[model samples]
Each structure stands twice: as structure tokens, then as C-alpha cells.
Target: MLRYTLMRLGIFVGCLVVVWALVYSGVAPRGLGDSNGMWVVLLALLVSAPISFVVLRRERDRASERIVQRVDRMKSGLEASRNQEDAVVDGTTGAPGRTS
Candidate 1:
């Protein structure tokens, strides 16, 4: 998970730097005054999304697989516990406990 997050952050930063350079060099339209930084950030996010999606495909799929396995493990454990409880109930009920 941490790896995935860091990868995404790296992509966003890369996009930001590239876009900032383009605007700084006058290749892209410059934002006026106050909104300049915000514009760069928004544009970075927009550009980073597709780039990250493509670049991080393997990591993303690995993370998804890990999450699914964890869920399956938890579900199996819960089912096993329920089955044990049911068995105990059936055993006790079938042969009632006797106190001497």
C-alpha cells in the first residue's frame, strides 16, 4: 500500500515539475498572479492520473490481489469459527450434560 501511494505521489510530482517548467518557459499559457500555483497543481493531478494508471499497472494489480486475498482469509476464518460453534451446540444438545 505504501509503495503504491509513493508511486502515485512520485508521478504527481513529476507531472507538476514538467508542467511548471513549460509554463515557466512560456511554452504553456502562464497563469496570472494568485491562481498560478493552484492551476499548476490541478493540471498536475489531471496529467498524472492517466500516466500513473499506465505506469503503475503492475503495482496496482498486486495491491488489488493482496487486498482480495486478505478478505478471503478473513471470510474463511469467520466461517470456520461459526462451524465450530455450531458443532459444539449440536454435540451438547444431542447428549445433554449430566452432573453427578
Candidate 2:
């Protein structure tokens, strides 16, 4: 996840630099008076989105798979704990707090 996030950020920053350069060089149109910075940032974001989506697809998938596995592990742990508690409450396990 961290890797993917960093990669995405890198792509955005790269686009921002390129867009800024283009605007500075008069190749790309600058926004209305005083809105040049905002325009550049927005354009960078727009350009980066698709680039990141395609370039980081593998990283994104790996991150998602890791997240899913972690969630599954948590769920299984909770189920096992619940089963143990149930057994203790039923007096089947020698839990310390059991009266019988």
C-alpha cells in the first residue's frame, strides 16, 4: 500500500513538473489571470490519474490482495476467539473464570 501510494504521488508530481514547464515555455495555455497555478495543478492531477491507473495496476492489485488477506486473517482470528469463548461459557474448556 505504501509503495503504491508513493508511486502514485510520484506520478502526480512528475506530471505537475511537466505541466509547469509547458506552461512556463508558453507551449500550454495558462489559466486566466492569477489562476495559472491552480490550472497547472488540476491538469497535472487529471493527467496523472490515468497514467497512474495504467502504470500502477499491478502495484494496486498487490496492495489490494494484501489488504484482503489481512482482513481475512482478522476475521478468522475473531471467529476462533468467539468459538473458544463459547466453549468456555458451555463449560467444555477449563477456562479460569468458569464456575464449573
Candidate 3:
């Protein structure tokens, strides 16, 4: 996840630099007034989104797989705990100490 995030941030920063350069050189239109910086940032975000989506597809998939594995592990742990509690409550266990 961190790797994907850093890559995305890198792309955004790259786009921001390119857009800023374009606006500075008068190649790209600037904002109406003092909003030039905001315009550049927004434009960069817009441009970087698609680029990041395409470039970071593999990274994103790997990050998602990691997340899913974590969630599955957590779910399995919860289910096991629940089963232990049920067994104790139903008197299936030979000796019962504490539920917690």
C-alpha cells in the first residue's frame, strides 16, 4: 500500500511540475486571477489520475491483494474466537475457566 501510494504521489508531483512549467511558459492558460497555483494543482491532479491508474495497475492490484489477505486473516481469527466461546457456552469443552 505504501509503495502504491508513494508511486501515485510521485506521478502527481511529476504532473504538477510539468503543469507548472507549462503555465509559467505561457503554454497553458493560467487562472483568471491569483488562483494560478490552485489551477496548476487541480490540473495536475486531473492529469495524474489517469496516468497513475494506468501505470500503477500492478501495484494497485498487489496492494488490494494484501488488504484482502489481511481482512481474511482477521475474519478467520474472529470466527475461531467465536467458536471457542460457543463451545464453552454449550458445555462442549471438558473444562471451562473464563469466556474472556
Candidate 4:
């Protein structure tokens, strides 16, 4: 999970760098405005990246929660079956000291 987060952060940063380079090199126009186009693009990227990351992280957390719930339910069912088996064994044993 930490690795995945780091990888995603690296990709987001790389994208920002690429965008900056493209704008700086004049390969892409900044925008049709009085403000420096690069600054505007940068601002937008800065805002969007964190929001996107947070949204993705929230979704990942929800999915993890669901998986944990399912696993716990499965474990509980297994335990119940084991207990039932134990009860059946005790019933068939008849007397405590008896063996067949």
C-alpha cells in the first residue's frame, strides 16, 4: 500500500513536470489570459492532483474495508463449523472414559 501510494505520487509529480516543460518550451500555449499561463496551469495541476489522490485513496480504503468484512465472516463461519464438529464428537463418545 505504501509502495502503491509512492508510485502514484511519483507519477503525479512526473505529469506535473511534463506539463511545466511543455509550457516552458512553448510546445503548449499557456492560455488566453492576462495572467502568466504557466502559473495558471500550475495552479490547476496543484489543486487537481491532491483532490484526485484523496478521492482515489478513499475508494481504495472502502474496498479494503469490504474485503476485511468478507474475510472475517468467512473465518467466523469456519469456527462455527469446527465447534459443531466438536459437539458431534462429544455426543458420539458416550462415556468420558470409553474408547472404540
Candidate 5:
């Protein structure tokens, strides 16, 4: 989870840097005071948002599944270890020559 969050932060900062560079370099056209640049930026964001959301959601789901599976395996291992210990105790106590 931490790694995913960091990865997203990195990507966001990278995009900001690239956009700032473009604007600084005057690569985006000036709109003759019409402010069409704002509209273009908004349109780009609207289009990119859903695509980024879908990709991130898929990654998060996969990571969650992996964590769940790992936890389950650890639980099963602990249970098996406990059962083995119980069996050993039972056998030692149940022998005819043994005293409680």
C-alpha cells in the first residue's frame, strides 16, 4: 500500500514537472486573451482522469488479493504447527506408563 501510494505521488509530480516545462517553454499556444488554454487543460484532465482511475484500481485490486493470499497461507501454517504440537502433547500424556 505504501509503495503504491508513493508510485502515484511520483507520477503526479512527474506530470506536473512536464506540464510546467511545456508552459514555460511556450509550447502551448497563446489564446489571444480568449483563455482557451484553460478549456484545453480541462478537457485533457477530463479525458485522462477516468483512464488513470481504471488503471490504478486494477493495480490496487491485484495488490489486495496478493496480500490476502499471503495472510491466509501464514494462518494455515500457524494452525498446522499448533495441531502438531497438540498431537505430540496428547501422545506423551496418553501413554500407559506416563503420569499426568
Candidate 6:
């Protein structure tokens, strides 16, 4: 997860630097707002999104799989704990003086 996040961030920053250079060099015209400000960031995000989608598919999938597995494990643990608690409350401990 962390690896994928860092990789995505790196790509975005790289794109941002490229955009900034283009704007600064007069190759790309500055638009509505200052290209050096939020405009550049938004442009970077737009450029990076597709680049990351195409280039980092494997990393993104791996991160998603890891997240799903972690959530599954957490959910199973919670269910088991709940079952144990329910059993105790319902008097199913199978010990002396405990009802089924």
C-alpha cells in the first residue's frame, strides 16, 4: 500500500515538475489562474492519473488485494469474538451450572 502510494506520488510530482518547466519556459501558456499555483497541481493530477493507471496497474492491484485481505482478516476476528461473547451470554459454556 505504502509502496503504491509513494510510486503514485512520485509520478505526480514528476509530471508537476514537467508542467511547471513548460509553463515557466513559455512553451505552455498559463491559463485562468496562475499556472504555478493550483492550476499546475490540477494539471499534474490529470496527467498523472492516466500515467499511473497504465503504468502502475500491477502495483495498484496488489495494494487493493492487500487491503481486501486485511479487511477480511479483521472482519473474521470480530465475528469470532462476537460469537464467543454470545455463547457466554447465552449460557452455552458447557460448564457446571451453565445451561446449553
TM-score per prediction, in order, is 0.81, 0.87, 0.90, 0.43, 0.51, 0.84
Q: Residue 65 error for model 1, in Å? A: 0.9
**Candidate 4 local lDDT, 5-24, one digit each (tens):** 66566656676777777667
Best by TM-score: 3
Model 2 residue 77 CA deviation in Å: 0.7
Cα-based RMSD of the predictions, in order?
Answer: 5.3, 4.4, 4.0, 10.5, 8.8, 3.7
Error of 4 at 41 (Å): 24
Clash totals for all candidate models = 0, 0, 0, 0, 0, 0
* Model 2 C-alpha lDDT versus the unseen true structure: 0.94
Model 5 agreement with the true structure over 1-100: per-residue lDDT tens digits:
7766665655555555555556557785544566656644554555445545665786778779989999999999999998787778878888544333
What is candidate 5's local distance difference test score?
A: 0.65
Instruction: Please list the C-alpha lDDT of all candidates, in the order they appear.
Output: 0.90, 0.94, 0.94, 0.70, 0.65, 0.86
Predicted candidate 3 versus true structure: per-residue lDDT over 1-100, tens digit per residue: 9999999999999999999999999999999799999999999999999999999999999999999999999999999999887776667656655454
Could you tell which candidate, 1 or 4, scores higher by lDDT? 1
Which whole-number lDDT from 0 to 100 does residue 73 have in model 3? 100
Q: Kindly indicate the candidate among 2 and 6 with the higher lDDT.
A: 2
Q: Which stretches of candidate 1 lie over 4 Å from their true place?
A: 95-100
Candidate 4, overall lDDT?
Answer: 0.70
- Clashing residue pairs for model 6: none
Candidate achieving higher TM-score, 4 or 6 = 6
Model 2, residue 74: distance off in Å is 0.5
Model 3, residue 59: what's the lDDT? 96
lDDT (Cα, tens digit) per residue for candidate 1, span 19-78: 999878988877777898888888899999999999999999999999999999999999
Q: List the residue pairs that clash in candidate 2.
A: none
